[model samples]
Target: MVIKEITYGGLSREHLFDRLKGYPIFLNEFAEMLLFSPHFCPSPQQQSLSVAEITVGGLGLQQGGTLEEIRKQARLLGLVECPLEAAFYSRFYFTDQEEVSKKVVNQNPPGALVIYSKPLLADRNFPRGLYLRKIKGDLWLRGYRCSDDYVWSPLDAFLFQVNASSRTLE
Candidate 1:
């Protein structure tokens, strides 16, 4: 599906990161929009748009109230919670045990992950962009997105899952 381009406009990197630190979905949506819609701007009348997203972290997939944990973490670091205006709901997935800790050793990190890597355009920087809960069953990445927001192929998802698993092994 066609998406819209992200208009960072006057937003600075620090501002973006600061906004994203507490709300990972903002970054996820931003990336998705940038990738899909390099130049997408709907008419002002197009108010309802579906957005799909995938967030992988300690928690596995998307779950409700996950943002509170993210917000808490950001609060600890003196950040603010992201507003609903920044994003919308889509889909969520929780990683299985095999994905959390791998038996094989690789260049990936060790933990649950949901990552995707593309060319210089979009790449999943696992373990780095990822944040560990430091505890189990606490939900890794606390975010969600709508289905229309993402238009991923099976190969894309598989490759990302594989890479994410590698990170857990590390």
Candidate 2:
């Protein structure tokens, strides 16, 4: 099942942009930061930071759960074509191309739907990670103040690079 999730990139938007010094920042770089340092993804606090579980849906593939419901949700989001195993890992979501063309012209979040129909390599033991082909014309990009904090690891960085490069390749 396709699911909607929010990923952490280990550094805030502001910190990242400050480090970039105005250089174009890509998702891969975020992944690298996660993997580069072991402390990047610290274990969840023993006590509950909040009662809410981070898992959006019960489709916990990592914890031996099913993804049928998650995929159904993605379908509800209008993703007609998607990988069969996409639910086993992670997937990115964005608007379609035509929508992107119309809405992405501005610097705000692109209206296109971009799905990274694959999982992260670090989460599982597979190489080549997941593939995020531009299934639609929507660019699926976002801009924000450089002061956001998104933590990541080196492995995360590698995955980010792989994902970003794959898009560029296509």
Q: In every candidate, how many clashes are there?
A: 23, 46
Q: After superposition, how far is residue 35 of candidate 1 from its true place, in Å?
A: 15
Tell me the RMSD of model 2 versus the true structure.
16.6
lDDT of 2 by residue, 1-170 (tens): 22333332444434543443333323333334333334333222221110111121221223221233333333443333222122111223222223323333212222212222333333322321222222243221221211112221111101111222122223
TM for candidate 1 is 0.23
- List where candidate 1 sits over 4 angstroms from the true fold: 1-12, 23-105, 121-170
Model 2 lDDT, full chain set: 0.26
For model 2, the stretches where C-alpha displacement exceeds 4 angstroms are: 1-27, 42-89, 92-108, 112-145, 148-170
lDDT score of residue 83 within candidate 2: 28
Per-residue CA lDDT of model 1 for 55-162, tens digit only, reads: 322223233223334333323332332112222111122223233443323322344332221122223431112222112433333222322223222211111121
Best by TM-score: 1
